[model samples]
Target chain A: MKTTFSLALAGMLLSTTAALADTTITIESWRNDDLTVWQQKIIPAFEKEHPDIKVKFVPSAPTEYNAALNSKLDAGTAGDLITCRPFDASLALFKKGQLADLSDMKIMSNFSDVAKAAWQTDDAKHTFCVPMASVIHGFIYNKDAFKDVGIDAAPKTVDEFYADLDKIKKDGSYTPLDMGTHDQWEAATMGYENIGPTYWDGEKGRKAVIAGTEKLTDPQFVEPFKQLVKWTDYMGDGYKAQTYPDSQNLFTLGRAAIYPAGSWEISVFEKQADFKMGAFPPPVQKAGDQCYISDQPDHALGLNAASKHKDAAMTFLKWVGSQEFAQIYGNALPGFFPLTKEKVTIKDPLANEFLSWRQSCKPTMRYTYQILSRGTPNLENALWAASANVMNKTETPEQAAEELQKGLASWYEPQQK
Target chain B: MAQDRKPVRWHVGVFLAPAVIVYTAIMIVPLFATLDLSLYEVRDKVAAFVGLGNFAKLFGDPNWSGQFWNALWNNTWFFVVNMAVQNPIGIGLAALLSSNRLRFAAAYRTAIFVPTILSFVIVGFVWKLILSPLWGIAPDLLKSVGLRHWFAPWLGDPHTALTTIALISVWQFIGIPMMLIYAALLSIPEEVIEAAEMDGITGMSQFWRIKLPLILPSIGIISILTFVGNFNAFDLIYVAQGALAGPDFSTDILGTFLYRTFFGFQLQLGDPNMGATIATVMFAIILVGVCVYLFGIQRRLRRYQF
Candidate 1:
């Protein structure tokens, strides 16, 4: 009996010591192709820095991310640190007291005010996340394809842009603008993220719409959507049949002149495209209009309020905003535009070109699904459907615009009470 | 009477308890719970009772009815296509394979059944690539046959997208009906065929008069199964077209609609109550279909002992 008791005590002591030696901090994020790089390079560097804490990443596909996160958070089975988009989804969690307040952290000093404000809760006081990166939404074009079509330079005005498209269309050798609306979201992505700012008069107009003070069907918004329909001609007959990946391949293979895509695609383009690639801001509304790029923060890291390892998780969150982590991020996936105020040089030329928009042009807020409230008709979804309807000639621009207004009203009017 | 009376069969209840408990826990309980939730609306993360408001919105409100009706019609079209194309083709293949004189019958049967065993993801992606105009073999094959001009992007066009997906589903699942019908054909006694032969009914006539009638019950069974399966279908369309059911939402179906509502997409928040409402509606649809078959059709279709 004494021997058994002694053995039990020894086993307990060994297990306790092993547990004390390493603390695991779990992070939840959407699965990306860069995940392998993150696992190999990022996690190891962090582990090396803090020997007492081990980090593990939990990932779900983009489609499944929100649903999986919601269930996990509700069940209190979520990771120590969670990845969420800025504004609403994170704000919802914050309101429910699911996230820890990070306003007092010294590490947050690395972020710009704009970056910090993007993830702030409603009171604009406490922050729930460390902003990681922001992507510039714009057009990715084949520089060589433009030259082949006898176009010497990227368009600076709306008419010049249309003229370039016509030139490529007249050449009859390649598709002018490569986009596949088969998945349907691409149309909205192009409309709202890439081109909407140019017509909505940039960030101020967007803030107005989000504030519900300005209507979506106003003349300013309507004009851009009307202009949006003209590109249907350049998309070719297979545009409806075209999937996003198909367009990517078309652009990469030099089969298309220009592709409207986000900065996130830079890494893939650099690896795949054999020809010279360049990026340009969506053309200005008139000859003298200053160009703007939709700069938006991506997945931000937040601490789970229910986490057992609160100290370890906080330590990891602080390290995330550090320059060491930024260097690791730059080396592993240079395409992502880092959000830190520190000077981190990127080596990828295409990435640099996309970032150049930051220097030369005004930065505007990008459209996010987060603006639409939960449990209401989604304005973003309605806009996507309406845009597709316009392209298909099923709905006039007026009708589509009205439909959006109605959807917004459905959500907005109810909340007024 | 006292001698004939058996003691209470407590063992029978004991034997049935596990299955009943499991079924009640997993299926019946969830089903009832979903039905109960349909009458509520979730606002700001709290569920408030709204009665038939969701259903009214689904059927009557302009914002939702368009999508709801589109999905319903598409689902109906999907069911019709399967019944019209999948069943007849399955019957024909089954009849051919059941022939006693046919050589390598087992191999042919196995070859035809291969696609049924494949998952929806594999089938969706494979068909997507095969039908893709960019890097697909389809356009090339058509060109070789001098039918290149006839080739169109079937999956991309709003008019043909749902039909194309349905036909692809038919191609993958045709083996199910074929196998079931084949089994039914084989179960026919040799004496019955011999007797029919003696009566001068041979080959096509013999099949029409004898074999086809024997398999009516099986055909009815296959039809109802196809209905339920098609109405509840989701994965194929999702893997192929995504939740938007794009090219102007031409391929939207009830299953996808339910999924989009329940889980939410893009900016829309997930509403469990509304999802429950959609599920309850789906249950009613399936229940009505099953009842009509059970009472209206099956009662008249004879399952002959011979």
Candidate 2:
């Protein structure tokens, strides 16, 4: 009995020493597709830098992530690092003290104010998450189909865009626009928001609307819906029932000429498309007009307030905000551009093409994301239906705009007045 | 005589204890808790008692009331579709299967009842794939029958989406009513049918006059079950059309609306108080329906001992 007790005491001492040497911290994320990338490339690089801090990436399905994370946080069983969805979702967590304030961290200096804006409090006094990546919105077109239609250059203006689409329709070989209304989000995200930025003049119009200086019924907002309605003729037959995947498949199969896309589609399109693909920013209203792109911050990383291994998690986050980490992640995931201000060279040509638009066009996030969607009858969801209905010819752009404005006015104090 | 009163029946309490405890824990407690939760509202992230404020908002606020009424209307249509199409078809199939002249009756029953055993996810996905305009077999199959122009994207059209989904649900759940009514039809004593035949009632007339009347009690039970089931339905619509029940929320039923409100969807935060209000309303609806069936309908239906 004495020998057994002595052995057990020695085992406990060894385990404690091991624990002191190494702290294993887990990260919770919704990006299940990035599991292999995290496991094979990212984790190894981080582990090589800090051997004392072992990292684990645990992911749930994207749709279930918010619910699962909320429940886990409530149960006090969440991981050390939590992947943050931009804007109000993460802001709500920070407000609840579930996410640690990262303002004091030296790594917070790496990102621009615009990059960090998503995970900050309304007053911008407290920053919560380390901004990671942003997806730029534009058009990804099949070069072969464009050649077949005899359109040598990407459209620089809305009129040129319609002309090119008409040429493609006349060619009778490929569908001009490859988006669908079935999923609803694509109608708003890729259809309206993609081209809407140019009409709204990017951040200028976006902030004005938020400040109640501009209404959705304003011509700038309504024009995007009008442009979206014009897409119906180019969408070919049975586009109403076409799902996101169907649209993707149609483009990759070389059946469609142009795809309204977020930059996130770059890697997938690169893998799937046999034809050469090219991207262009949203067309301007007229020649010499400044263009704009929806450069939305998609994801971030934050330290869990209840985490036991704060030091290890902070160390990991600091690395995530580093120039080296930016280079690696930017190259590793082509479409998901690193949000850091550091100049990271993109290896993928299509992604680089998408990145180049940042030089010419003003960048703005999706308008409905930040503070407008907090009330009943969420503006973002309302936009999904409105965008689809306009395309379906069920509701005119004027009516859709009026309805959205009225709904916003009902609850939002700024819009009410 | 007072001294001879029955001793305490400890075994009776023991026999009932487990079921009573389990039911109370799972069902009765949550039901009451949901009702209680509906009376509260979240203010500055703290749940404060607001009495009937949530109900008032649900019925009074334009945004909330519009969604509530739309969902209620859609749910009513969904139930109506099942009652009009599924139950009648189920009865017809059950009648045919119960007929003595029918061959391969067991095979037909198994084949027809197979869909009820499948998961909602599988059924929803398969139907979606089959009906898809881009890659689905629906258009091609129609073309082969020389009716190519007749085929449209039914599931994607706002006007047809709800009805199409309702029909798909009918296809899945028809087996349930069929099996129930089949059993009810089988349990009827053979002598009653012989007596009906002797009285000159035959064929369709015989079924209408004797079998259907005899099975009225079973039919009543099925109607109540369907009402409760339809009002509570969520899975099939969720799996098929998503949380928004797209094509302009044309297919948004009460269950899906409640789910979106309680759990939140996309960018919207979940309002548990509003969710609870919707749930409480749903419970009340189902309760009133069941009560009406019990007191008004079921009581009127004659149950034959034979």
Candidate 3:
């Protein structure tokens, strides 16, 4: 009896020691292709230095990522670290006391002016999400395709843009544009995000409108609508039937001349063999419209409130935002063009040019439909899904616009009161 | 029998307790809760009972109404496609594979069923890769067949997108009907077949006239199963086309619509109340289908001794 009791006591002590040794923190981020880097570089560096901490990184698959994050959040145990888009639910999650205020995490000092401002909340006091990366995604046209049609560059005015598109269509070796609407996010790119600079006129006015200082149907938005339709006309027969990536490939492999894509794709395109792709901002329209880039924090990381290992989670977040981590990612194999101020030398020439263009832009906002449309709950559902109807000619652009406004009215009118 | 069983209400309560508790907690309670949510409007991030307000917006508001109808119509077509294409194909395959002395029958069954074991996301991704014009096997296969012209990017084409996805779904689930009908066919004995032969029936006519009648019950079961599965389908569509079901929402189903509404994607804000309303709509739809089968169809199809 004595021996058995002693053995039991010894086992208990050993288990307790083991438990103490592992300060496991599950950190959630969208899946990174550089997972081996995380394991080899970040995990070891942090774990060895911290000694008392062990971090378990759980990456969400593309399809499972957001929904899984929200469900985990609702369950009150979404790991110690969570990955979420900067949106109403995440904002609400912050407001509902489910997230830690990382306001004091000295990581704020390293952020660039625009990056910091983009992440700042309504009050501008708390940063609910630590910035992972940001990109200025806008319309990109192929230079070679444009040159073949005897156009030197993408037009800077609405009239010239239309004339150029007409010329390209007349030449007709390939389509000038691919509407590729099968992927819903691509529909969002064409239907909504692309319209920002043209419609709202500029950065300051656009920000004001999203802040509810401007009406949904400002006179400024109409011309852009016309310009938007003109771009659609450049698409070949059955334009709405194609997927976004398909459209990109067509432009890349010399099938189509123009693809309205974001800067995130520059790195990917640079790797394509035998094809030299170049991008400039969407053409200016109606005299005042300069090029526009939608500047949403592509994805952000949040600290889970209910994590058992909060300290370790915070440590991981700090590491992810550090200059060293940024350097590793920025210089990785098939690397990233980080939206950070880490100043890592970009190896891809295309990425360097795109980043330079994004940096020099005088006017921009963190995307409108993604930000402004959130005034109505599940507004993207109606707006993005409504694009299908628009393509089928079942719903007119005016009808799509009205549906968007009505969704907002229903959602926000009550809340406003 | 001895004393009228004393009409034991207490015994009835004891017997019913476990099931009632389980059902209430799992299904009934959640259903009522979701319905209650539909009646309430979200206020200041909290819910207040608003009484048919959500439904009014859904039906009366143009934006909400259009989507509600679009998803409803799309969902209906999905079911129709399954019934028209999936059911007949399943029935045919089951009939063919159920024949006596079919060598490698088990191997064929396992091979055909392998897709059903895969998660919907996996199935969607694999099919997306296979169908993708970029790296998909379809374009190459077409080129190899001297019919490369036929490859016009099936998945990206809105006209063909939903049909393609439906066919993929059918490919995955054809096994369900195959298994059930195969079981039912196996149960109809050699003695019965011999007796039918004695009655001047044989071969193909024997299958159509005699064997098929005996398997009517299994067919009914398969139909109802298809209805429920079709109504609840979401993951594959969501994977192939994000929540928006793009190329113009041609593939948008009730499940994807509900998911989009409940868990806002991109710029959309999520509304749990409306999500619940959609869920309630789906429940009512499934319930009607089951009821139609139980009350209307099942009653007329009399069970046979064979």
Q: What digit string (tens of lDDT, one per residue) describes model 1 on residues A243-323?
A: 788988888888998888888888788888899988888889788888888887777899999999988888888888998
Question: Poorest 10 consecutive residues of model 1 chain A by lDDT?
Answer: A367-376
Q: Which has the higher TM-score value, candidate number 2 or candidate number 3?
A: 2
DockQ of each: 0.50, 0.68, 0.31
In candidate 3, how many Å is residue A325 off? 5.5
* lDDT of each residue in B96-149, candidate 2, tens digit only: 999999999999999999999999999999998899887899999999999989
Clashing pairs in 2: none
lDDT of 2 by residue, A22-91 (tens): 7999999998877888999999999998887889999997766876787788789999999999999889
Pitting candidate 2 against candidate 3, the one with the higher DockQ is: 2
Per residue, candidate 3 scores C-alpha lDDT tens digits across B29-123 of 88899988889887886779889889898878766677789888888888888888887887788888988768888898899878989898899
Measured against the true structure, the TM-scores of the candidates, in listed sequence, are: 0.93, 0.96, 0.79
Cα deviation of B199 in candidate 3 (Å)? 4.4
| Highest TM-score against the true fold, candidate | 2
Compose the digit string of candidate 3's lDDT tens values, residues A1-417.
999999999999999777757878877766554467568766787777777677777776654566667777778767887765655546766776777778888886777756655445666788867777655555566677777879886566667767877888999986877666567566555545665565575676566655556554455643444445556677755455456666767766777777777666665566562566666665665556456555555556778777777766787788877887666655553224455676767676665655665655554654443355555445555555555455545566676666655566665543222
Measured by DockQ, the strongest candidate is 2
* Candidate 1 regions with alpha-carbon error over 4 angstroms: A1-17, A368-370, A373-375, A414-417, B1-5, B51-53
